[model samples]
Target: MPMPGKYSLQPALITVADQIGFLKQFFSNCFRKGFEWTEFFRQAYNVGYRSTGIIALTGFILGFVLTLQSEPTMKQFGATSMISGMVSISVMREIGPVIVALICAGKISSSIGAELGSMNVTEQIDAMEVSGANPMQYLVVTRILACTIMIPLLTIFADVIALLGGFTATNLGGAMNPWLYFYKATTALEFADVIPSFIKTILFGFTIGFVGCYKGFHSNRGTESVGIAANSAVVTASVWIIIIDAIVVQFTNMFVYA
Candidate 1:
């Protein structure tokens, strides 16, 4: 006879296997017939344009606070003029992408999970299959592709907004030329700093979409499962974001920055 707790890992292992199968299905459906272009564009608009306000606010605050906090330390080191470069590099390389991705993981991921979970519970997904429609293409692929395409663009937008915010914070102490500040910031960023960060944001976006959809689609057939799916999506996506960021940073250090 098996021990009482011997099968504790079974559920986790099953979940991992299920997720892998779902990922495989997603890739397979990507190249299948009946790609939903309209849905894709709609999801893209919802994911990208609708998110600008929060991203802008977050970016501005991030840059402004970072500059203010670093001013004292830089002054002590007689590197006040390097503040713009420092802020730009920090935002472009690490802070901007990771922070924006986390925020999206909370907002976008939860929204997708709740929406899909509700559909699943209401039998809408089943109804679609009965109607001979590809729910995976219309729902999952559109959402996942939209997120994968939009997030990097959003991150770039956030980076620019952050630089402006940093400039605003810099001027609070004294007047500085806008052109000079921007020039310094731009010069501080290099090809190596940008490419890796961009790659990470793309991966972050995909992970966010995949986890959200998977949780929602596989949620139990109950109203309560919708909430659980949304919450789980946020938590799982956030954890994955951090893990991917750590792994990417390590690889970048080994290959790009080395």
Candidate 2:
């Protein structure tokens, strides 16, 4: 006889173990024979190019609003001249990567999960296996790799857009030269600030793709499970993004900042 509470964690433990195994398989297949370069490029286009509009819009709004909100506080301290630097550092170091990753976790993760889940439900994956096609290599590996590559690029794009937005917002308050604003923003950032954030975005992208693929690939055999998989993928990926961001920030503080 065992307490119900004792067994309550069993499901979670099993899920963790299963996910670890899946991750191991992914790494194993990632570098194996017959890499799908064409599929990888296609997925990269879908992941990166297709996402530009939304990322641009979000980044602009984020920078504009952040500048507007911080103006009053900076004025209070008489540090108004440092607004561009503040916005740039905040966006480049923290806000830009994290926010963009969360947005992608919602958009890209759900999209991948639903697409794969639908395939799983319709037995398309099974059919591929029957036809002796390497579906995992063609599908999962390409998608995950695309995400890993594109996400950092997207984050960099967002950071530029955000700085532009900040410049716009700053000009709205008073006249400022574009070159001067950009110069301040660029000078405020160092290699330490940019590289860590870039690395974080890469991890964020991999986590988003990995969670989405794992959930969809393991979804139960039903149409309803497709929805469940997509929803779960978004939630899980978002949670992991936050967790990874926190861990990275701690390590960065310890090693980089220190």
Candidate 3:
């Protein structure tokens, strides 16, 4: 007979296997016929357009605060003018993508989880199946694809706004010409810095969609489970964002730098 401790490990292993199966199914469904273009466009607008304000605000604040905090240290070394370049690299290569991804994980993941969980609980998803409507194709495929496409675009927008905020913060200390500040900022960044960050955001978006959909789709049938699904989606998605960031950074350093 297995020990009690060994029995406990069985469930965890089974859960991991089940999740892997779920992901495989999701990807297979994503490539099926009868793609919903109208729904995809609507979801894209919902994820990208509705999210612009919060992303912009977060980027602006991050840029402003990062510039202010780093300025004093640069001043100690009498290299305060390098702040523009430093902020640009930091925002573009690391801070902007990670922070925006975390924000999206929190907001978008929870939203998807709760929405799907509610539909699951109310039997709306089942009803669609009964009526010969493909819920997975219409619902899950559209949402996951939307997140995959929109988050990167949103990240680019955030990078631009963050640079603007950095410029404003730099001006607060002294008069720096906008053109010069932008030029320094632009020069500091290259494709090596950009391509990896962009790739990571795509992973982040996919992780968010997968976690949210998995949690909600598998949630227990109860009103309380809806909340649990949303909460778990956010928590799991955030953890994944960190893990993916670390892995991407490691690969980038190994290959891109080497």
Best by TM-score: 1
Model 1 CA deviation exceeding 4 Å by range: 1-7
Clash totals for all candidate models: 0, 0, 0
TM-score of 1: 0.98
Q: Give the per-residue lDDT of model 3 (tens digit) for 114-204.
A: 9999999999989999999988888888888899899998999999999999999999978999999999999988899999999999998
Task: Identify the candidate with maximal lDDT.
Answer: 1
Write candidate 1's Cα lDDT for 1-258 as tens digits. Answer: 875486598788889999999999899999998899999999999999999999999999999999999999999999999999999999999999999999999999999999999999999999998999988889999999999999999999999999999999999999999999999999988999999999999999999899889999999999999999999999999999999999999999999988
Clashes of 3: 0
Stretches of candidate 2 off by over 4 Å are 1-7
Tell me how far the alpha carbon of residue 161 in candidate 2 is from the true structure, in angstroms, after superposition.
Answer: 0.2
Estimate TM-scores for all models: 0.98, 0.96, 0.96
Model 2, residue 247: what's the lDDT? 97
Better of 1 and 3 by lDDT: 1
Our tally of clashes for model 2 stands at: 0
Question: How much lDDT does each candidate structure score?
Answer: 0.96, 0.94, 0.91
What is the lDDT, from 0 to 100, of the residue 28 in candidate 1?
Answer: 95
Please rank every candidate by lDDT, starting with the best: 1, 2, 3
**In what order do the candidates fall by TM-score, top score first?**
1, 2, 3
Better of 1 and 2 by lDDT: 1
